[model samples]
Target: MFNDDEKPMAPASNAGRPAVGFSDAGKASVKAEHSKEAPLAASTISVLLDVSSSSSTVGRAPLDLVVVLDVSGSMRGPRLEQLKSAMQFVIKKLSPMDRLSIVTFSNKSDRPCALRAMSEAAKSDLKGIIDGLVARGGTNIEAGLETGLHVLADRQFTESRTANVLVMSDGEQNHGDARQVANPHGVPVYSLAFGADADMKLLSDLATNGGTFNPVPDSGNTGMLAVFSQLMAGLLTVIVQDLHLILSKPTSPDDDLDKIIKVAPGDFNQETDAQSGTVTVKFGDLFSGEVRKVVVDLLLVQATGSDYEADMLEVAVSYPDSKGVRQKFRGQTLHITRSGAATSVRATPNLVAENARRQHAQSIGAARELADGDDLEQARDKLVEAQNALEDVLDQANPLVAILRTELQQLLDRMESPELYKAEGKAYALAAELSHARQRFASRGDVEGVRLFATPRMDAYLKQAKEFAENPDAPVPNADEDAEEEAKANPIALVAGSLAFYIRTAVEALQAIEKIVTATAAAGNA
Candidate 1:
């Protein structure tokens, strides 16, 4: 055997197509379709998210791996042996061109033991050092990080590719607490927690800076080794690696949905693969109220042809105001396809109907307690808990139900002060939002699904807004922002307001929502 743990003698030229994200069933379908390729590992997919919206891959290639092994007294047994075996797996998996280094700390301030290099010679030598590893001394968490950085040498990292540190530990950083001092390695570091005695926080902190932290609770060293393997293999397929996203730009939520979506820092990293070719992506993020912009970041993999495609990525964000009022905005699956993997990404944005129904009943009872209680936070707590429980059932994507979930969330935000005009207005707006969401639901035409969706309170506030706004006795609307503050909404006002909103959204989605609402009303009246 020419040393399975020997360093990769040469760098690999990534020359394959990018893979797509799909449902498990869809994935199986594709796998079966491609079963004829005997040499292909179709089951292996490398997924990279473009979280940076720049044209460069952060000026780095991808392999910045630092091995932080634990040789403390407890790890002296077969555990240490298993770790070396796992380390060997990583060595066999990585390319010679990627950066590799090792760090170990025991006792108060012991110097690190490391062999740093970007060549096969360095890795080859490190394998021997790994095999000859001996367990001694107590754990000193601070020293491990300090030595990791000393070996990494910050000044040299600017031109490195895939700069990262992999910290494997079964002990806490108990000796001293200088973790934050030398911890900012200015790159991603993945944490691997081993055994029961490992400190999750220490590993989490180490992985917090531009990296991910993973835990190996058992002695499944093979799985731990595979994590690194998957991460590296995906990196090789990427071309454009930078992306950014922002949602709901331009319009103020002061009551609007005809929003403008903008993508800031929209540039993506440049990328190309042999089979799939080059891929460029647009990244985005969504904000509440009137959407003025959407920002996105992405890692471009490859494409099969010139046809435009889109893949989906979903994001959820929320904030709680001082009065224990919660507000939120949800982004559906992000699509990134253009002769690449975009069209295959799906968003199963389904509402938890079963849970929502259960909560709806409990909420009615809770509403009684809420009205009698002065503690808004306490009241809000129950509401959030219920909503969270309902969110659990979301795995399918249906539009009508989407509206109810959004409405329920908004209702939770306003529950504390149902009498307040602002809260009431929000409720009305939410009702309108639900009305729109319902229209999308009809497109699916599943009776059982529709019945489940209709179970939620349609909260007819928008219908009331319309009647009040059109009242002959009501004064002409004031354009002043303060005027909106003084206005109190009733059923008529809600119906009129709802109509105006319906018109705006109808135009925005190019689907004529107002027409649909009008038709709905007429059919109901008939």
Candidate 2:
């Protein structure tokens, strides 16, 4: 799980570098053990491709948004009010260039308003429509989605604009086929599962088609607003769209592109042309400061008595800028050398640590599933296995190891305390879900905010920690002398402060790693 204090990678100070970068586990140099009689040798190479946006401010694209609200019987009081507040917040953030549509569903779907530009008059009219919303009947998610799609499709496309649907629901879909409703239509459907009863699987399926799924926990109206605001931030800052990576076939006759693994932006659709020996991967939209990473594996076979340099693979990237202008990056080559030398260089520590983190995430996910099934012991064992694996590759000198170790220990503690685990099980589950989401799609900064909102208690502690850090001389609260004494004995304050310290340390370590990588790359070029 990501800590509250762990900040995302800051933009590189240098501006000449491309936003996207490619690296590997190590230089693809393999020492061959072939003798006079040996005919062939085999080895595998791993490549990591990272795509990031520069920190510079860019023009904002106009948005065509469809707000789908579920006014079901379950959402009668505070839930309905919170939903209304969230919608209004979104409205305030939109500019005149953006167009908005409102769709409400409860056994049936109703489009209260069509796509209208965010003029003062339009905002007033939408607020009136939102204020009149009432909760009743069943949940017709299909109707909500279909109506949203209709609104979006009806709009005429303008230059440099993006469109999508935001579905906010607090219950299970009682009618209609949500899957059929979410067919490919160029526009993605971002779904928010409001409250515990919201059908996560249904919303996940809807968003998986082309968008993201967020679970809005029942943590009152404030939490609702936070989640909505975070989503809006992502929508408003999209810097690149329709990003595609094409991997051409290797030039070496003896080598083959074995596999392509998407290590980040969790759920992406990829297609391959068997005849052309080419692979195409589609990454939807990238917000500024977001990074998308992927790894490709290649298998190389060398004929006997041959020492040669082989072009392992070529990667070409294409995407549209915020202005809808197409930009292409002509492919770069990854070379591998087969040598008779006695030694081969080891993989870089950063690459090794990244791979370990990926594996750890997978392990944590598997353990969560087992725990959900009431197999706590097995879950602990799985996590223990993961911890051991991480320890094998991570040395004491690496600061990340300590951070990771602390996270694992905290999770293990949760599992061991039955009372604590039962009380905070949902929060724990959500933390895992959010962690996986960040690993797959959300930007690092986005994940930090979302995770804080989703876990109320943690958020409170983190906030308190920040306050304390900013004003160390401020007096601690106390109701009376006894209360003041109790406050002094309280572990919560200490834990919160410690968490803040750890988070700062972890973030600094990550920044140091980035600097090291930059320096190493420059040295290699020199």
Candidate 3:
């Protein structure tokens, strides 16, 4: 665990908007040791972009959301009540500018509420519909998703908006193929695995194109609420949209065009401009405080004569500002010296960039493949190999590396037995991959590593929600609980604070029970 004093990365001076930074792992040299005629060398470089939230006078973008909720038999009892409580919180958070629709699915799927702006009256009606939901019949996830798409498709596309689909399912699909449902609008689809019976692997696959897959370990109210809170944080904090990153050689006629021959953009959608030879990666939208690392391997050709400087590559980024005007940030030119001397040269690696590269690479997928093939030992060996490399190159004390090493170790522990691997190892692997690949903090609906991107307000709400769910009747600590002298000196102030705390808790607990009672009564009526 990282100490409270430590940070994941150094704070960027450019705090408001996304800023571009560059570093090379090592320099490329032309001459090989002990030989005059040697093949050209290759080098790896990384471009790290800090996507921080801009100071906004206007609030978050207007949201067009569709929630596909599961009403299967498995979701009855506490499971459904917990879900309703979370949904209430969600409805309470949205503004009038945001539009929402609710789609419920079981043996069949239907929309209880059509897409409408979150007016006060509309919110009340939605809450009523949410409380009255009854869980029954088989799970038709395919029908749910298709109906959701139809809802979005039926809406007016005349305006620029941020749209998404939220999928909550606690059981396996028994009706049709959810994977085959096509999303013509290309809206991101965030999924939640509500309980143990959920098909995590399938949900992970569905969220691959865009969006994230969050796991809620069980039907516990706190976990459910935390997942919903995290989802809200992501939806309301998109700072950059239609982000485009372009990579190509310098345009100078004298510059060496042949220096960079290939570019591999891992898992991101890319298009190579044949005429200009520039690779453009489409990173649709970035949330507040998110970090995206673009690492590309470059092959450099060595000059025959003396040492000289050569341009490696240039990176440029573009995104639209709030006023709908395009903004561009051009990265500084990267250069390295080419040496022709017969002596061997050693290149110093940039530990930070290299570590980021390894984390984003194929280790998780490699292990998953081996484990799926029944080669459990090889899967464990693959993780060990990755961990060893990380240890060799990175300082073990670094906060980021320490956290990563700990997670890797946790995965390693699961491979000790086939029974263990079958139970939860695979889920851990998927979570780690999603966390790194998408550069978001994803886990089993726990608060671990959530502070990485969660704003202070959201963080406080999550901690409080978790604490309340764990022990609703627990007393709130006095403001000066640890400072005995201060508490004694300010007895009157302490009494006032305690009174306020109790009042808040009483109201919140009453509200929770009210929702539960309403749902229970509705179920009994059916």
Candidate 4:
């Protein structure tokens, strides 16, 4: 426990590099909670590390994005057309500050469009190039990735700019090993498996650098566009990069330090230092209004002090600001109140943290493996068990619980029937469950499934995209138009503003009628 005179450490700053004001007042906040705050004796303490970014985060960084496309013979007719349409949507969505590069692969690769700012003329040229792309030859995914990674690596500006690669393919690679292609710059390479024939495992392996391998079943232009929109939503609103969380025991005079038993970092990579007994988990980048939860199990020793609180762990979060300067949030202490009586303390669990653990269980690849192995019974049973565990902690009426229930039920449905399991069922189940656990938004298993968990911005853009797809002649809505529509949808404040005026006018009319009646009566009496 911290002494009365002790204060939380201030945010650390680099000495030379200038700190740019990027996010809002609170860039990010970290809080740790225990399932059982007060325990009678030594027990496993479930520590939930809740990390969130500010909703009002400002200073959007410029983007350097590369779209690596596969123009193999397999993607001939509708597949090629859908790919072009998706590329056009991506180009339209980017702002002038953002740069886009295109790479097409068929046995080999070609960079038709280099990294250039998204000006009106540039966008037009890119769209034309996309339309002119012809599908032929075999797939060389390695060459495409190599070209894309090189294009992104050779950037003119580094400060206050974000870079990423998007690889779209629908066929197996007949060329070099894609996994061997090094991502030295650590730019996130998101993969879009276009159709059923696409190798999801290869794509998944390639996306180890802070990216997701999203499976897009052969649905249509809308399906392709939906996935793109979801990816862009996070990429465009990047608030922090190279984020890391360090967990360690609090300092004390006695040799009684808490032990970090285990950690479930969920899709992110983690490293533990043997000498220092500190664990660091790399979260890569965080988007505005995004949440990343890390669960840790600790063995806490009894505190040897007169204070009533026992400090168990200290959590410190660090990330690079837009200017490439390292900024650190003050370390926070998770304390449990010390109790004397054995029966006095009640073990109350933190439902949010507990539910997150349950969600993580579903995403750990067990269900995916079982489903892939054709063990439908075991897979369904695994999902049911996780769902039941979630229900045990949370009520069915809770929105969080409902989301888990819906997800589990959908997976169960897929497992019971062979037809559904084969037709994008397994893909959907894995992607949905993983997205939930990782807190990354993705398309639903059913191609036409409604957007369940997209950011407000992404959801609006998707709605507009669907509207335009329905009728190409209709004018596409802009941000201002979206805001207006939202205001119209909820006009309570507008009505309230005029409510006072209406009441005043009504009262004045009643007073005038009373005066007129009094005047008429007086005149008749006279």
In lDDT terms, which candidate is top? 4
For each candidate in the order shown, give its overall lDDT on alpha carbons: 0.39, 0.58, 0.62, 0.67
Per-residue lDDT tens digits for candidate 2, residues 42-63, read 5555566665542221233456
Candidates in order, TM-scores: namely 0.42, 0.68, 0.74, 0.79
* lDDT tens per residue, model 3, 317-413: 6666545566664533445555554244333244353444455347867997799889999998988887776756544555666665667677788
- lDDT accuracy of residue 119 in candidate 3: 68
Candidates ranked by TM-score, best first?
A: 4, 3, 2, 1
- Which candidate gets the maximum TM-score versus the true structure? 4
TM value for model 2: 0.68
Query: Where does the lowest 10-residue lDDT sum fall in candidate 1?
Result: 26-35
* Model 2, position 108: C-alpha lDDT score: 94
- Candidate 3 Cα errors over 4 Å, as ranges: 1-59, 257-259, 304-310, 323-331, 337-361, 413-419, 449-461, 467-526
- The candidate with the higher TM-score, 2 or 4, is 4
Query: Which pairs of residues collide in model 2?
Result: 265-440, 266-440
Q: Sort all candidates by lDDT, best to worst.
A: 4, 3, 2, 1
